[model samples]
Target: MRGRTLNDAFIILDEAQNTTIAQMKMFLTRIGFRSKTVVTGDVSQVDLPKDTKSGLIDCLEFVDKIKGVKISNFDSSDVVRHRIVRDIINAYDKRKK
Candidate 1:
């Protein structure tokens, strides 16, 4: 029963700013059998208040060694949004220097 058999599924979590550390762990644990998940978020763009910790940031700090989890970093150069966005990011970088 090929059609009836359950197959692995792919899921992508984008703009996961509202998730707390606990929520992230729960979501990761809820993956169905034979499923893969990819979670992506920008820590800097977090909409949560500064006092609130983002799951994405927590995961990055603690889950790097977890099996099947890969961490990749993107900087201002990866900005693919409006031209001014990249420029603004670059300008901020210059200000820090």
Candidate 2:
């Protein structure tokens, strides 16, 4: 993942919240011509060290103003797991506020 470029490929990076700022930048730069990349993460569920900044959150801030970048936000209603999962997410979200 260091020096290779992904060309004409579809790349998906899951759990992006676990990545560091520098890692996200490196991953994004690997995209080459005709490549489509998707990064998915739940900022609320980040597992990085407490002092570390989440790359997903950082990327969102910078890419929001860039052209050809689209961001989609989903709530607990989007949870497709067991019904209890959605309830749990909603409970935690409520507690956060």
Candidate 3:
């Protein structure tokens, strides 16, 4: 396995919408030396209980303050899904206010 070393690896965590705040913190700590984390989840699609806090939700503020963590926010304009998807997203946004 000496010559089988991998140069790059990509780790993607799906259904991250279901992770609790504590689990998210534990997973984030597992990042390897040369590995990077791409944590993607839709807050609007969170599956956690109404009173539960999502790791992805709480980490945003903490990650933003970290020097190397990168945070990106995509809105309706960035929607690449079906047009109806964007419309639904917009509709929800309107109702949240």
Clashes of 1: 0
Question: Which of the predicted structures, 1 or 2, would earn the higher TM-score when compared with the native?
Answer: 2
Each prediction's whole-model lDDT (CA): 0.77, 0.93, 0.79
Candidate 1, residues 1-97: lDDT per residue as tens digits?
A: 2223223878778877668888777777666668777888877678887788998888788787888778778888898999899999888789979
Error of 2 at 7 (Å): 0.8
TM-score of 2: 0.95
lDDT of 3: 0.79
Off by over 4 Å in 1: 1-7, 94-97
Please give the lDDT score at residue 10 for candidate 2. Answer: 99
lDDT of 1 at 29: 68
Residue-wise lDDT of candidate 3 within 53-83, one digit each (tens)?
A: 8888888767898888888878998999899
Candidate 3: residue 73 lDDT (0-100): 79
lDDT of 2 by residue, 1-97 (tens): 9999999999999999999999999999899989999999999989999999999989988898888788899999998999999999989988989
